[model samples]
Target: MDWGLVLVLLLMGAFGGFSAGLLGIGGGMILVPFITMIFSARGFAPEVIVHMAIATSLGTILFTSMSSVRAHHLHGAVRWRIVALLSPGILLGSWIGPWIGKQMSSTVLALFFGLFISFSATQMLLGKKPSGGRELPGTVGMFAAGGLIGLLAGLVGAGGGFISIPFMGWCNVKIHNAVATSAALGFPIALAGTLSNIFYGWGVADLPPYSLGFIYLPALAVIATASVLFAPLGARTAHRLPVATLKKVFAVVLYCLAAYMLWKAFH
Candidate 1:
């Protein structure tokens, strides 16, 4: 184990966990970009770095989401009924997402991830809440929505909060409930995405040692451990902090990451 790299992953995990807890984002947005930079710095193969970053990020979210959602559940904020309704579709879509991603070149994958991250940042910066005059759709409709959310999140290595929160709010779910429910939904998205990515990345050439499919095992383990420890603290802070202001600051950081990915994609 490289102690230096372990330290870096620890710090990233701490921050990512806090952000996951506070923002209901499951930390993938932050993890994916940084993991890309780290792997690139380490001279991982260009063909595999982006895929590994995405896969590892999703794997870490498996732990982060569990920690964050447990906190949210304690607050009685999670809408389990909705989670049940959406998960089947989320699973199906998430499974397909990585398969599609595997077919894209690194440049194209990075470009796509960058674009979506920028869009998510813009939404955060604008602080635009979807109008709330409707109720959640029927099971079939929810399944379709879940599929779309899961697919996009898998592609970008997000927690599905970017799409799910807005959709929930649009359907008149309260903001707190939306955030909590999104956190709960992250598990299924991550589970399916991570597994699918692993399957697709199996037997790929030039993979790093200790890599399980596209996931760097060391990074995933370290990050998930660190992220889990901090997630509850972040969840506690979320109710106390001026989250709107924080979101703007986080959005700015995301813009910088997006710019980096764009540069990576092109050169």
Candidate 2:
């Protein structure tokens, strides 16, 4: 393995993990675009690059989510009841999402990826706070939302926090609690997405060595290890920093990255 590539992966992991911790946004918004660039630069088959990027990003999220959730739990921020309520649907949806993704053409997936990123960035910039007065959604609604979130998670290789946090907040959950519960959801999302990717890409020809289906194991290892180690630190920093300012800054960065990704996809 090239040390240079390893270094790049580590840096990507650190940035993505830190952003996840600080903003409660899933790392996929960062990881997917960066990984796509890496794969493209490495001269991988254009047809397969997006799939590999999404799959690898999901695999890495498994570790980062564990670390982030644990950190939030330590601070008593996690809402276990919410996690329990939403997870069943999330798990099932996550399992099915990648399967659907596997059927889509690469160009369509790239466009979807760009649109989602832009939507997430707009949400962040709008500065919308959780409604904060109503009860959690009913069982059916919760499950439906979870299923939708999971499907997106698997298809895009995200932790689902981008959707989960906002959805929880809309249900009148506190912002902190919403983010905490979303963190817990990440584990299931990552697990289902990873498994689906494995099955979806199995037996495909001309894949790079060291791949487990669409996932690149070496990249996953380097990113996951580094991201996990630093996640707690990022969470701690969030407590001290002015989060609104951070959110705006992060939103700008996301927009820039999204633009670059769209450019790459087109040109």
For all the candidates, what are their Cα RMSDs to the real structure?
A: 0.9, 1.2
Off by over 4 Å in 2: none
- Write one digit per residue (lDDT tens) for candidate 2, span 148-252: 999998888888988988887788777777776777788889998999899989987767889999998888999888888877777777778887788888888
- Please state the error at residue 4 of candidate 2 in Å: 1.4
Report the number of clashing residue pairs per model.
Answer: 0, 0
In candidate 1, position 208 carries an lDDT of 91
TM-score of 2: 0.96
In model 1, residue pairs whose N, Cα or C atoms come closer than 3 Å (at least 3 residues apart or on different chains), thus clashing, are none
lDDT, residue 14, model 1: 99
- The CA lDDT at 213 in model 2 is 94
Cα lDDT of model 1 by residue, 183-202, tens digit: 89999999999999889999
Local error of candidate 2 at residue 95 (angstroms): 1.1
